[model samples]
Target: MGVGEQLVTYVTQNGYYIWEEFYRHFLMAAYGVLFASIVAIPIGILISRYGRLSKWVLSFGSIIQTIPALGFMALLMVTLGLGTTTVITTLFFYSLLPIIQNTYVGMKSVDQTVIEAAHASGMTRFQLLRKVELPLAVSVIMAGIRTALVVGIGIVAIGTFVGAGGLGAIIVRGTNATDGTAIILAGAVPTALMAIIADLIMGMIERRLNPANKASAASQ
Candidate 1:
C-alpha cells in the first residue's frame, strides 16, 4: 500500500489506542499548567505587592526558563525517575515564567486612581485585590495561562522519553520501523491537531475575558 493508505489503515485499526494517548497527552499538559498556576499566581501577587522582590523572583523564573527542555527533563529524572511525575514536574517549571510574569504585569496594570478610590471607600488591601484588581487583571492572567498550556502540549510530547506515554510514543515507534513515515504521521498529525485545537480554545477564552472585548460587545 502507499504511504497514505498505510496511514489510513493504521489509524483505522488503532483509533482507540490513539484516542487514549491523546487524552493522556492533554491531561499531562493541563495538570502541569494547572499546578504552576496555583503556585505562580500567588507568588505573582506577592511580588506585585513587594516591588523589590519582583526582580529577584522573576529573574529566578527566567533562569529556569532558560534551561533546555530535554536537559531540564533529564535533570529532573535524576530525582523524579521516569513516568508522568517527571514529565509533569518539568512542564510545571516550564510554565512558571509566563504565568508569574503576566500576573505581575496584570496587577501592575490596574489603574492607580481606581485603587485610590477603592481605598477611600474603606476597602482593605486584600479586599481591593480580590474585588477590583483581580477582576481587571484576570484576562491578562488567562493569556499567560493560555500560553503556558499551548507550550506545555509540545513539551509533554517529549515525555515519552521518560516512559510517560503520549502520542510521542507512537512517533518513537515509527522511528524504529523500517518505513515508518506513515506511522510517524499518524502520531504527529494528532499532536499538531491537539495543539491547534487547544490554542483556538484558549484564544477564545482570552478574547472573551478581555475588558475591551466586553465593552465592544456591550456597545454593539
Candidate 2:
C-alpha cells in the first residue's frame, strides 16, 4: 500500500496508543520550552542592560541555534549519553535564541521618554522594568517565545534518534523499516497539528497582553 492507504489501514487495524505518544511528545516540548524561557528571559534582560555586550552574547546563542538538531544531539550524547536528559537539554538550547533575542528587542523598543518619566518618579531600575517596560513589551517577548516554542515542537522529534522517546520514535521506526510511511505520517501529522495549535494559542496570549489591546479594553 502507498503511504496514504497504509496510514488508514494501520490506524484502523491497530490498537496502538498514538494518543499516548502525542501526549509524551507535547510534554517534552512544553518542558523544554518552559525551562528555556525561565533562563532566557533574565539573560535577555541583562543583554539589554549591557548594550555593548549584547551583540557577542546573542551571536553566540545564535550560533548554537544554527546547529542542526540531530548533530547537536550527537554532540550532547558524547558527554551526557542518550536519554530524556540529553533530549531536553538539546531542545532547551534550541529554544534560547528566539526567546532571548525577542526579549531584548522588545525591551529595547520601549520608549526612552517613558523610562525617563519613570526615573523622575523615583522608580528604580528594577521597578521600571517590572512595572512599565515588561508590561509594554509583553507582546514582543511573547512573539519570541512563541517562535521558540513552535520550533521546539518539530525539533523534539529528533530526540527519538537519541532515545528521547517522542512522536519521533514512531517516525524513526518507520524509517528503519524502509516502508513505514504510515508510521511516519502518524507522528508527523500530530506534530504539525500541535505546532499550529500552539501558535494560535500563543498568538492569542500575545494579543491579550499587547499594550494597544489593553488600552482598547480600558476604553470599552
Candidate 3:
C-alpha cells in the first residue's frame, strides 16, 4: 500500500483511540504542570524575597534540568514504579527549573520605584507583591508556565515507555512494528500541535493578565 493509503487506514482504525490517548497525555501533562507550578511558584517567591536563597534555588533547579529525562524516569520507576505516579513525578521535576527561575526573575524584575511607591502608600509586603509586583511580573511568570506546558507535554509521551498510557503507545507500537511513518505521525504531529496550541492559549492569557501593557500596546 502507498504511504497515504497506510496512513488513512491507520487513522481509520485508531482515530478514536488516538484521541483518547492524546487526552490522557494532556491530562497527565496538565497534572505535572500544576504540581510543578504549585511547588515552584511559592519557592520562587520565597527565593526572590530572601535574595540569598535565589542563587541556591536556581543552582539546584539547573542541576535537576541537567539530568536527562529518560535517566530521571528510570530512577523514578525504581522508586515509584511504572504508572501515572511515576510519570507525573518525573514531569514535575523536569518542569521545575523553567517555572521557578522565571517566577523569581519575574518578581525580581518589578520596578523598584513602583515597589517604593506602594510602600510609601502604606502597602504591606503582601499588598505590594499582590498589587504591584505580581501584576507587573505576570507576563514573565506566564512565559515560564507556557514553556513548562510545552516542554511537559512533549516529555510526557516518554511515560508510555514506563507503562503510563498515552499517545506514546501508538508511537512505540508503530516503532516495534517497523512502521516508521506511523510512529512519526502519531507522536511528532500531535506533540507539535499541542505545543503550538498551548503557547497560543497561554500567550493570550499572559496578555490579558497584563492589562497595563495591553492598554499601552493598543494605544500605540
Residue-pair clashes per prediction, in order, are: 0, 0, 0
lDDT accuracy of residue 146 in candidate 2: 94
lDDT of 1 at 66: 88
Clashing pairs in 1: none
lDDT of each: 0.94, 0.89, 0.86
Tell me, what's the RMSD of every candidate? 1.1, 1.7, 1.7
Off by over 4 Å in 1: none
> TM-scores across all candidates?
0.96, 0.93, 0.94
- The local lDDT score (0 to 100) that residue 143 gets in candidate 2 is 97
Q: What local lDDT does model 2 show for residue 142?
A: 98
Global local distance difference test of model 2: 0.89
Residue by residue across 159-196, what tens digits does model 2's lDDT show?
Answer: 88888888888888878886887888887888899999
| Collision count of model 3 | 0
**Model 2 residue 125 CA deviation in Å:** 1.8
lDDT of 3 by residue, 1-220 (tens): 8767887788888789888888998999999999999999989899999999988988998998899887899999998998889989998998888999889999988889888889999999889888888888888888898899999988888889889988887778877776568555866578778889998999999888775877798999
Sort order, lDDT high to low: 1, 2, 3
Per-residue accuracy of model 1 over 62-136 as CA lDDT, tens digit each: 999889888999999999999999999999999999999999999999999999999999999899999999988
List candidate 3 segments past 4 Å from native. Answer: 217-220
Superposing every Cα of model 3 onto the true structure, what RMSD results? 1.7
